[model samples]
Target: MRERFDVVPLAALFLGAASFLMPFAALKENRVVDGLLLNGFQLAGPLYGTVAVLTAFGVLTGVFLMKNGSRRRLLYAAAGVVCFWLTAALLVRAGMMLTGGAAPRVSPAIGFWGLPAASYVLIDHSKKGRWRMWILLVVMLLPAALLLAGGRGEAISVFREWSARKGRFFDELIVHIRLFGMAVISAAVLGIPLGILASRDKRIGEPVTAFVDAVQTIPSMALFGLLMAPLAALSRTFPLLRAMGIRGIGAAPALIALTLYALLPIVRNTVAGLASVPLSAIDAGLGLGMSQRQLFYRVEWPMALPHVLTGLRTASVQAVGNTAVAALIGAGGLGIMIFQGLGQAAPDLILLGVIPLILIAVAVDRSWGFMIRRWVSPGLDMKGLSA
Candidate 1:
């Protein structure tokens, strides 16, 4: 057997070198003005700059030196995360050194993003791990938390934007979560039964699934646009809906659009889950004189739970990202910040909004998965059932 060289660490090293060769940080005079592009050496000075270089280099060289795969993985994960955190810190430090520790409009440049993204990918193992993935998130985020708590991050461009809009941030974040949450929950409630029905009855299933799948075909913005007219009419005709804030350009339309978008993955997965249930198990349930409802509740549904959760997980993550577009219609989420940032030509404001949006998606993806793995019976998994 040939020894397989680890490409992960090499990729990390390539990204790190790119960080050194290209601009590591962009320096701006103000939030909306362009300035200079600073390399790692230019931004962090000798000590921190040298450390960054050595850290990045050590990740690849050290990993190759170790023949043991476990040791190589451990080294790369540790070094990669450190490089990522350190790159962020360097951006913060650069701001301080240049602007007397007050707010500085310094953002991570293209080169800076490559390394951290590579590092993040390095530790983000299987999406299935109960704790491993969460632990990686914590490890990755701790530096940001500490910098913010200790106030060192205040000078960084992204934090400066946050400080300016702290109140609006929370308000918009709540709306974003609400839109995403309601959409996914609504999808699950409506999708699961339809999925089950489709599995149990071909007549009802084919067209229903076809429609749900068709919903996904429409561009999200176009779907949102299509809903606007009916929603606007409803609000005008129904005083109660108007009183309840069911407007065409706000949460009501946004929520409906997001829910429609969320249904397909869920319905597809639910159908798949139920379809995948064993004939033997169904026969056993029938042998005990169990009716269809009893079999579904007691045997089929329970056995298909992991797959259901998988669908829910998929829908939830999609909803979180899709909810961002809701901001365009005044539905409001972190997307507002992103759009505002773009309108104002302020990169930091965009980062403040975009980062949290990514985090929310990651949180939904991880937490739901963690719950599925931790609570769902090991035997209930599709793979287990097939075996």
Candidate 2:
């Protein structure tokens, strides 16, 4: 069966070559020499036609190379790629029409559509080991090629223009980073100590946990307002702690608010993780002549790390989103863009802020989740780890 199937690639090659040549032949028949003369070597027509041919050839190649059981899978993937490109092309056409078809460059939808298909083909073909590196190399390089070919000067220019807004950009970024950092650090410093105390004594644990749970019950915006006065007062005493040199009403209040909100998850997770350590394990460590410090470092902490990391991940993502609310308090970040857009009724500007915030939250969550699943979690390998 493998020997019979080996002819498939050869057949695919012939079919692909025929499909490519046939399109050019059809184009040539339209006004023949005059059409060729008008296009100055018929460049643009052939370029577009070539992309269409290559796209089809990729699908055919993928079909021929896949095993019978996997052929359906490959076909589905090819269809998906084609659908993606078609939808993107349609959207681009729509956008062009909306803008009176006078945009400086091709629609971004083309790159968005084409790159994935090319990457899929490169990755699929490279699996045989012989061409794997070359396939990946092309996949990596194809974006730059497409970018150059598509003449993304306007896109680059827009970004360059935005880059000139460095003050607002950095101001927003720095404010958010500081707020998030303060939230995480304050939660860790305060929560870890409370976690240890709670683990040591139920009397302290119950009341503290109840208070944190109560705080958690409060809506975030309400809590932000509730804490602002107290935090604003504290900021008066600590001149160096103010964010952006705006003393009373900026990131200081936001940071304190986020920190208070972050504490419950961290402390609760820490307490639970520590408490989950078996009593027998602790007794065994003691019986083996382990010191209190030794037991905690060697056994308890290692066992608890996965849960702690989980809490941290949760807190980080929460802090990221919550920082947007801080914008209401003049703690400027991407939220500034969101509010600016809202005021101006510009969805694009709103997206500029909201999209990056979502991306940052997701990226941080995934990366930290991977770290915990891979290294921190006990008795699990990569294949079994939850995403």
Candidate 3:
């Protein structure tokens, strides 16, 4: 048979190989100061040279040479991921071991960034990643998760930043989740009804559509600014509101603005999903003694659900990012660490905040995709979804 190269594994090889070519980590005296670059091979030469070199060869043979759909191909790819994982963990441990008496901290450098990036692509490469990849991926990640939970990543700069602020960090993280949840839920509550009305009545649809579309055009900062005054005034006017923390520059105004920004996507998708429902299905339901409401609930809604989930998925991810901006108005979340890191010129601190946001967004998006695939109405066309 002729030889063929898969883009996914090739991409993984490029990233992982490229990562080691440059500095793998940094040694710093303090969080904000200039640091010395350390090559993985130099810092932990025996470990890096052996594992990385062996894995590079393993990836080439196992992923590149093996036939597509072969179990061995997948096993090799998963092994490559696990090898890289051990290289990172053990290398960091060795590096930290060196710093015991000297006391200078170790931080990730530019090249260090590629390890996880390469692993992610490798994850995608493992048999289209539909089953979430070879068992090796799970085995490797389980301990990593546990270590992170146990706060054992002391060698990495971001982990150090996390160690310093973990108490407040958890608190801010919960608040951030709340902000994202409230925004998406509020938008869905109002947007879905408006979408239903819009589908049934063009008159109401056009105006509501225009209004939500206009809301999207406004910059988030400006929207937050606009809501603050009215909220502040309301709090002042109503002692009840003030006691409930409905101030202009806090969660109240931030939630209102985030909800407004989230509305357009939800409303637009709701309209699209409903309209996409087949008339034949509705007619069939009605002929079977179903009333209009029964038809909507039993026939139309089931068909439209996948699209509705898509819109909510979009809104959910968007809310995660926008919630970061809400921190500017004292609506606390991970953004507090980000802005504070910026003010102090601490890159690791910024990363401590930014990384979580990225993870949260990816988690939400993937969850929605999982829902559409597994839990949605069987009436949905798989072809449309794949497209």
Query: What TM-score fits each model?
Result: 0.90, 0.64, 0.90
lDDT of each: 0.79, 0.60, 0.78
**By TM-score, is 1 or 2 better?**
1
Per-residue lDDT tens digits for candidate 3, residues 174-239, read: 999999999999999988888889989999999999999999899988988889888989999999
Best by lDDT: 1
Give lDDT: candidate 3, residue 224: 87
- Score candidate 1 by lDDT: 0.79
Q: Write the per-residue lDDT of candidate 2 for residues 1-387, one digit (tens) a residue.
A: 463454433443443343223221111111112111111112224666567657656766666666655454445444433433432332233223222222222222112323344434433433333344455445444644454334232222123324446578667877777788789899999988898789889999999999889988988778778877776676677776554463556766777778888888889878877887889989999999999999998888887776677777788899999888888878788888788768866444565677678878967886786688666755622232234
Mark the regions of model 1 whose C-alpha exceeds 4 Å error after superposition: 99-103, 125-144, 147-150, 380-387
> In model 2, which regions exceed 4 Å deviation?
1-167, 233-246, 377-387
lDDT of 1 by residue, 1-387 (tens): 557765776676676777777888877667655656887677667887787777667666776677765666666567656766767776776676654323347777877776676667666521224455557668867875676566666566887788887898999999899889999989989999889899989999999889998999999889989999999999999999999999889999999989988899899988988887889989999999999889999989987788788888889999998999999888999999999889988777888889999989878886886688776787654463211
For candidate 3, the 10 contiguous residues with the lowest summed lDDT are 94-103
Instruction: TM-score for candidate 2, please give it.
Output: 0.64
Which of candidates 1 and 3 reaches a greater lDDT?
1
